[model samples]
Target: MTIKELETRTGMTRANIRFYENEGLIAPSRLPNGYRDYSERDVHKLLKIKLLRRLQISLSDIKAIVRGNRLLDEVLEVQLQTLQQAQEDMSLAASVCETMLADHVAFSELNAMQYLMTIETGARERRSDYFEVKGDELPQVHQPWRRFFARFFDMMLYSSLWSASMMLFFNQNPSLQSDASSIIEGFIVLMIMLFVEPVWLHFFGTTPGKALLGLKVESDDGGRLTYGQGVARTWGIIGKGLGYNIPFYNLYRIWKSYRMCSDLETLPWDEDIAYTLKDSKKYRYVTYIGGIALLIFMLYTATAMKLLPPNRGDLTVADFAENYNYYLKYFQMDSDQYYLDDNGQWAEQEQNGSTVYLGIGFSERPVFTYEVVNGTLVAVGFETHIVGEERWVGSNDQYMVLSGLAFANGQKTVGLYSKLSQELVNAIDSHTFESFEFSQDGIQMRADVTYAGYNDFDSGVLIPMDGASSFTYDLLYEIRSNNE
Candidate 1:
């Protein structure tokens, strides 16, 4: 009720409580006599303020937390990180002090090089609490999938060895395989089985997975991993993996996910060794999505799109190595454009609300040949040679294969069968044709040879008639319905 009583309740002096009160971290009311009246809420706020101040949190952050302008966890998270960095610096300084003491060196006798040498040695020996001596170029973090696969490979080997040993020793009895209460067993296993990890790390500077993937776990100074450092690294990795062993089921999963999501490139647990993957490629772009999608893109582009029958068909040599080799290529359509993402997946760029996306069959290649239209891809007439000789596309009638994806009300419509009627197909193909005129009724195909020097006489169907020039409109119901 009073400042004295409030101070007794909060274990803080009246001056500190009043200072917090003035800072608005805690608010108090006045009684009828004009004396300060403290409530239970005020006592609680004062206690929190004292605790936050003791934690070395600035009053500004504490005030924000108290006023609900900031979350306590967010402020505390940033503060904790600052404190952690300070602790690391303190640890390094303490290590340097110990090194000097052990070597019987005095501060007055210390020169720049000798002092610098002490820190360098400290970095190698006590790398867990340090970094930064390695200089400006931080190595790239290994892609997530690389680290995932490496662990997967090593675990597979571990599982195979463990299973084989069990079968050999226990006569393949299923009952002896796993205990009903395996959670406790797993906890014990985590604690006991990984002792040999340090041995492998010491000898090979990596586990089997790291070695197989062309990864090394060496110090920044390029020295072999010390036995103590090996043991620390082993424990760090094991700690990340032990989330499932915590006895409580759901809590264990949450912890496991958090640990696994930690940045793998830096290996926050073990700074003693830097992870290096693929000497040929300094950085690897590994997608968490399936490789099958990319593999399908590659093989389908090569065989189903352009290569099987060996037709250039308006498909350029540049278009078909495809992006499946994991190179991104930009394509601008006349009105709409699309590109392959870094993973070689087709991505459409919205073109002012009128974008066309090609729809190939689940196992099919792109239907229409693509040519650069205003720096983007648009449908182009396909070129082919019959009898192993280059055939005039004007003379040949098979050029209709060049028709591909079209824009239908900002949606993708494939010109495969029923959608391939002259009227519907011209809605899209007309945009790319050198010359085209069509209204709500009769359609006109007018062109003086497409950029590749091929003339179309039968509308946008691209069915060429040799020596036939000028415009021809296809009003045949049979051709339209046959497409259906």
Candidate 2:
């Protein structure tokens, strides 16, 4: 008979049946397809086991009787004596309860000591073979929340570090802003945690998060886990507890693990390993919160730094392009901004017609000129012209144009001349002019603003032309060596 048929015949749940099978109580043969084939004899054996269990016989005694290690009558005789003694104890307890009720004793007024003495005396005289219930089979200690938060803290720390590394070293933004990127980053962090967690467990018996939360993972012998054991336990946690952090399924696995933990069942990862937690204190929690805040701050600061170009020292043309792109992306100003081509030439997005700069439309591309001293870009300049036919310059348009120039020029404080001298911007800020020149600490900045007629495309210079209405701004910045 199949196991289902066996269930029907024996009226036992699949769990119970499987449990009994695991306990070696019954061995059903497997058919060709590897499904259990229960015999009629197996059903009889299950029924007998069920009857014996109802009689309050322990599984060990039943097994002994079934395996011919002990006679059924002998086990029954022992069970009978044990039950009669239990009955007498219960009868004595009932008599005591009746006496207390007859006395109309209030619980608060009742003498617990007196009742305990009477019960003890009665047990000593009547039940000579009685033994005290010490409750040695109590459930193991489990702190599911502490364990969870420790791992959470560790993962957050790892994520922050990984984000900082990616931004600082690779110039790649590791953001969790999108679902796909978040999942990929999360999986990578999980893998990193798995690899590093075992090392901590094996050497120190705890990780930073675990230590903060007063949790430790140890071997069965109450020592730090061996590396191999730690690896196995970590893998168990990743697979069974976290479900490999897969979408949707990870939640299910976490829920299942939580339920098991709440029920005081040993988690699979902790089968042979011991996970100990100390008594929690208020200060630890406060410190943990502060640490989390610090980590978040670190992540934000790294991301901000990544968004800014190298803010100090002489830069290459590529570095200048990076700063340009950073500004473009930061303000979301222009989609057709500049970039360094593969051949180290400056390039812009291909446009259909005219491009807008500082709210002014222009048909010609902006020109970039640079002076490199020994491969170090020492000076850079940008010039663009806006003709009158493109757009009429109202007061607002003129103000915007001037403000844009000031903003662009001020960026030198954080870019080209930033490392050269800090006082350059301070000096510039204290004065106001349509065009100004500032030289300090071997760094020189010159801004020449002029509104004129036409652009000299051939000569590559801004010169006065007849019958022309154009506005042009030229910004020339230079950094000189001490010897020069």
Candidate 3:
């Protein structure tokens, strides 16, 4: 028989027959001209597939039937149970509709709470079901995969948000990075989960992830949870769901949460929330579609970011100063009182008072500033802050980096500092500060007037000094400042 004959005999469309053939459910011999030549076996198999499909038997089971691995009665038993369960669900839905119709409930008033109350009332009257122990104990039961995906979606959302916050909140001083950054990021994620997740459950009874899995959060007593109960349920899952990066505790929570999501029994948190999960496949095939969409979104973002080139590694400070935006990617930097000049270099808004420049280095995080006097890079400097101390070290020291006082890596990172000079420091210390200038390696150093804080030297902090260094002033400062 030809495909048209097979289609007519099986009462299935040609497209449907072709799909089953493509799925490897039925194979027909190819004629010499390359056209399909269906046999009686193909027709018989299609009929069996069609019948089982009407009974809602899975294709895999039908394959077993076609291969003679299982009897129709054996397969029908499982189908019968599924049909019975579906019938019960339909009866419950019909009852709810009947109640609404009896109460003259308006379509606008037919919300989740109304349906919930209707179902609970019906279940109680029949003595067939209990919300706490009989049905799903929580909204996430038997849905480990959906729970895993919900967390994945959440983490991906937070990862992108945190990456953006590197510019949003900390764009001014990223070098302040510490353990506190992680805590703040976690807090932000928590707030979003609370706002978006619970509100969604309140209205729809399913999260975006669970909606795809055809799962809904069933209420505790047939009616919906009170506002407090909703909060408890949301936090019970999410609060205990994440462990704030607690060493092995986070992993343990993930594993335990996964188990709770998959198990039929109530989780420890369920005692507080008092809810269970129920299948709502009739709502839609959302999980599959949503999962695929989310997967695509993640891949696109990751690929786009990975394809971009990294910061300009070869550009010098002078080169960056000439056109900062060209190499802006390299600097993990933000400033509140800094603006770009026509030359594109960063300019400070105020020059009279001390201003600290904090930034992430090409190496480690560093805090420092460059001294500028009368439009000259007089001497670049670095500073080390002791949290409880009142004073700053490397505050005025120009030989800081080469002397091992503020170095990162080795010579490769020297460009991160200003030109080294001892003449300027000596002039300031001896109260001989006057308008004088000297040039070295095309960079200049100069001081305007006498220093006022020389008497404060007794309380000064010592900067690191290297006995043997290649700095032009390493030996000069070592011999001169050793006695000071």
Q: Per-residue error at 176 for model 1, in Å? A: 6.0
Clashes of each: 4, 0, 9
Candidate 3 overall Cα lDDT vs. reference? 0.51
Best by TM-score: 2
Of 2 and 3, the candidate ranking higher by lDDT: 2
lDDT of each: 0.49, 0.67, 0.51
- Single out the weakest 10-residue window by summed lDDT for candidate 3: 475-484
TM-scores for every candidate against the unseen true structure: 0.28, 0.47, 0.41
Error of 3 at 141 (Å): 5.7
Worst 10 residues of 1 by lDDT: 475-484
TM-score-wise, the better of 1 and 2 is 2
Error of 1 at 80 (Å): 43
- lDDT, candidate 1, at 451: 31
- RMSD per prediction, one decimal? 23.9, 22.1, 15.1
Q: What tens digits encode model 3's per-residue C-alpha lDDT throughout 90-192?
A: 6887877787778886677756686787677866765544333543333435556655765576555555555555544443223344677766766677666
